[model samples]
Target: MTVTTPSIAVADPVFPGRWVGGASLVLGPLLLLTGVLLRLPFDFFFPAQLNAHQHHPDLMTVSYSFASAGWVLLWPGVVLLAARIGERFRELALWGGALTVLGLFARTFHAGVDHLAFQLVAVRGAESATRTVSETYGAFHVFSTLNAAIMGGWLLLAIGAYRSRILGPVRAVGLALASAMPLGVLKGTTPLSVVAAAGLCLALVPLGVAAVRSGPNPRAAAVAGRLLLLIAAGTAMFLFGQAG
Candidate 1:
């Protein structure tokens, strides 16, 4: 009788990415929706937003913080989605993913500016803060060129998702609702913003949940090891950044 060799199990490279990316896809839109709803009571302008911030600092802080974090998380999730689409459809993934990522970055930048404007309300008062922000509102930045990307990206992504059969036609259209959201620093939410956010959640959350569930359950040790490594790396980078 011949002896048979045991087969070795190999790790899937996409596992870790899928886990984090799927979580991101779920959390990003929900967090952003929370932020928008929190700010909905305020008018969509620097003056009103600053006034809201000045009076309700805690509320505004939490709202904007959620928004900024969500923006940061979207790029990774978008990349993950693009990878799936690219497996069958390249052009849609390339343009849709690239432009969407860029647009997310630009929105993150606006979040930073929003923070600064709110701080200005404390330092210089809401009136002065409003005036300052208004005067400098249209100041040139490289991200200005990508403003259209924010809107166009969603449309392309919607089409791509539908064409790739990654999303149903209804869900793809729901995803496209994100294109309706207004962009800029110190702006507040509108009805359209709420709709857009709802659409985003509708389109991505189910897919995100499925993606996360589709992967094999990672070992507890592996999860712990990754957390430790992340903490160590974060500490190292923070120290390095301080030196820089």
Candidate 2:
């Protein structure tokens, strides 16, 4: 008589599946979309004189400023997603997320302050259009610089994830761009606006691929589904801001 051995059953992986359903997956796309939209009427990332090509001040304020606000909500999702993977660089991801959000908040206030400054200069009648252009443009550069620094932190986390294999080869490239964006800030003379916009656009690629590869994370997906409604709400807010 032969003795038969019992077979062992193995459990399937969990977190990778968790990827799709998470809030980060949902908000990441929305953030990308809103950022892209903000870039459309003009390159909002960069500060330039409001020429005829640009929207009126109010509309520009609504589109450009609020888009930054939307990113504030959107970025945390991505950070959290990174953390969920249990990577060693989770803290870096968290810090990067915090920095990005803080930067956006600062930039939003900067936009408001600059708008007021513009109005004051206009009232003075001594305000040369050239002067207004230079001042306004400079302020945007300051905010863009801050944003670039935050991106540097994010890049560090992305590289960490890639080295650990949490993020795939192609996906790592996108994160690399996200990380490098801050270098533009350091240069001072560099065109940070162009770099930031390009970086943000590149960021979408990794996020999108990760969302696909991780499959549907039920929790993340639910968060994403809810976020879609939030985006609708955001759209309403944008419209109201425009109308108001």
TM-score per candidate: 0.88, 0.51
Residue 150 lDDT in candidate 1: 84
lDDT of 2 by residue, 1-244 (tens): 5332111111212533333323344554455345435545453323332431133556545544444454454454454444543345556656655565555455455546545544544554323543555555444444555665556555655565565555555555555554443232101112443354455445443454444454434587787988899899989999999998
Most lDDT-accurate candidate: 1
lDDT of each: 0.83, 0.47
Cα error, candidate 1, residue 175 (Å)? 0.8
lDDT for model 1: 0.83
Model 1 vs. true fold: TM: 0.88
| Residue 221 lDDT (model 2) | 77
Q: lDDT, candidate 2, residue 90?
A: 57
Q: List the residue pairs that clash in candidate 2.
A: 18-217, 20-217, 21-217, 21-219, 21-220, 21-221, 22-220, 22-221, 155-179
lDDT, residue 14, model 1 = 63
In model 2, what is the error at residue 56, expressed in angstroms? 4.7
